[model samples]
Target chain A: MAKNYTKISIETSNDLKPKDETIDFLLNYSKALSVLKSAKVEFELVLN
Target chain B: MQEELITDATLVSSYIKGNESALEILIKRHKQKIYSFIYSKVYDKDVAEDIFQDTFIKVIRTLKKGNYNEEGKFLPWVMRISHNLVIDFFRKNNRLPKFDNSGEFSIFSVLSDTSLNAENSIIKEQVEYDVRRLVDELPEDQKEVLLMRIYNDMSFKEISDKTGVSINTALGRMRYALINLRKIIDKHNIVLTN
Candidate 1:
């Protein structure tokens, strides 16, 4: 029996930034969506 | 029942038995993280909200059908559902962001390219693993601010208020987090692509 393996090559870049508009968008969207989801669940439960 | 003390599996079982409050408790417990994971990919409030709702609805439907298997790991299951929904949202919209040669930043570009060759898939997986490991290795304060900002979708002001720090301090922590992550990637020679 032989085991299969995957080979990975690393190419590093210095351009990726931590803080960006995308990050902001994701964070804010998550916060708002989470609140909405919880409310929706509660509402659905009430109707059931 | 003390909802706080109840395990996720127990809450899920209760919900399956028509205990609505159990479902509510489950939602409240994992909502923030699940929502954040979805928004990280979709990055739209309304769409993320829609998908978030749909994810839970699907969860309820599946649970009712006795389909969900990861009883104790409910949050991870929900997160996976939200992630697939986000992908479906992109596919339906036909607006999957691609890597631009001009280098405009979009989180989608970092995810993966449309090409699905085995080699490229392996490389993408490795890159993702490396990046995740680097993030996990970040200092606690830096990682906290980073996750709150990126995963939890919090503003610097909100983070500052929540953590009892000045907004500047919160911003600085995020900045340092990025810089440190960049340094780690450079040191480890990890390559990221779309």
Candidate 2:
């Protein structure tokens, strides 16, 4: 594999203060919207 | 997911009353997991996107027809639909589903079970590494079956249809794959006792 991240997990999201797995999850959730937006932009560019 | 629109059950209630924004908000909220679940299944970036869209279309149709029974498990319900569509995509294509990269669906997320014991973190990492290593070396048939059953959580029936195999054969493949995996673990002498 290109990355050995299978072995190392830095626990970036888990902390004593707070973390946003939920927000991170939402960012992922917004992926479809971003994809739709980009495809629309590309189509508009092509039309223009 | 409806992170914004689903401030509470009230929004879903409004959604049930025929609100478009509520539906869109809900979709945007859980889009990533739905997409990842499908992408993980079919192992195609493009197909994942297509199935993701279709899933929402089904959701829209379901909602419009007032067929949404509010069980409060919105994302899981949506994910189930996305999962089925991805499997259907695999069925139509007549090809074994392969992970786009052995590492494409990174173990980080899968291993991100928040309850991971810090003391056993190293051991956990080692086990994960070894498991992944063995999984990588598995034959294409075994690897795809393992991924679908374990990762995608698809039922055996779903797997049979997706892989174009009979149900008995699908079960048999999984059984043999596990047997082979056990041999590999024994050969390595890596002890992970439950």
Candidate 3:
């Protein structure tokens, strides 16, 4: 009996680009997180 | 200097230091590779997109909390995160990805390498663009079949039905498209590898 082997190549084309909406959503989400983090820091400073 | 030329490590640190746009630069720079990796695993654009978002969100939380200690191996570290999330996706759905070993989902050894730095990514994008341009030089019929098969992920039957051609004809066109693409690549001396 002989074993068979197959090789597959991965395509690195631009066709797999994520939608712009996804990128915008991520930017906004990160911005909101930073805002909340700063707000928390300011509140902590006030408490101190 | 342009922000795009900044190293991923610099961008990561900048983002941690409250520079929001640094993260945007990082994301835009590497989004295609990350998204393509996830899509290769899940084969669903929407799910891959969601996983991409979640991966970045985890990155943000980890960086904000000062937990990201990968020591400048930004892309591989992010790839590892996305890989784990893909595994988690399968685990949640009570399924397993292909190429599992002893009930552990592990593949894509290429993702562990640090070869995909900023320069390499830019070169890869250029190669992709060049390949697409060469594809456009193909005959209209062959290019149509090739795009349908590759980009659209359509089966030969589907392509034939869509293009009102027989399955054999569609397959022939796909084969010729590849042959001609190789010739075009050779003629242009374009190396299509990252």
Measured by TM-score, the strongest candidate is: 3
Q: Second chain TM-score per prediction?
A: 0.49, 0.45, 0.48
- Alpha-carbon shift of residue A39 in model 1 (angstroms): 36
C-alpha lDDT of residue B91 in model 3: 91
Candidate 1, residues B1-194: lDDT per residue as tens digits?
A: 47789999988887666666677677766766666666667767667677877787678766755567963488888878888888888899877765655546766666766777998889889887877788899999999999899989999989999999899999999999999998987887876884
Place model 3 in a CAPRI quality band.
acceptable
Whole-structure CA lDDT of model 2: 0.65
- DockQ numbers for every candidate? 0.02, 0.02, 0.39
Model 1 regions lying over 4 Å from their true place: A1-48, B70-72, B99-194
Any runs in candidate 2 off by more than 4 Å, and if so which?
A1-48, B1-8, B97-194
How high is each candidate's TM-score? Answer: 0.41, 0.39, 0.50
lDDT of 2 by residue, B1-194 (tens): 33653463565566667554566566555656566666557666666667766776666556544567787577778878887877687788756635454744554655556775876787888877878888877888888898899989999999999999998988988988899899888888967742
Q: Rate the local accuracy (lDDT) of all candidates.
A: 0.71, 0.65, 0.84
Please provide, for model 3 over B1-194, each residue's C-alpha lDDT reduced to its tens digit, 9 standing for 90 to 100. 59768999998989888998999899989998999899899988889989999999888777877778956599999999999999999999876546655545557553467668998999989988988888889999999999999999999999989999999999999999999998887887878777
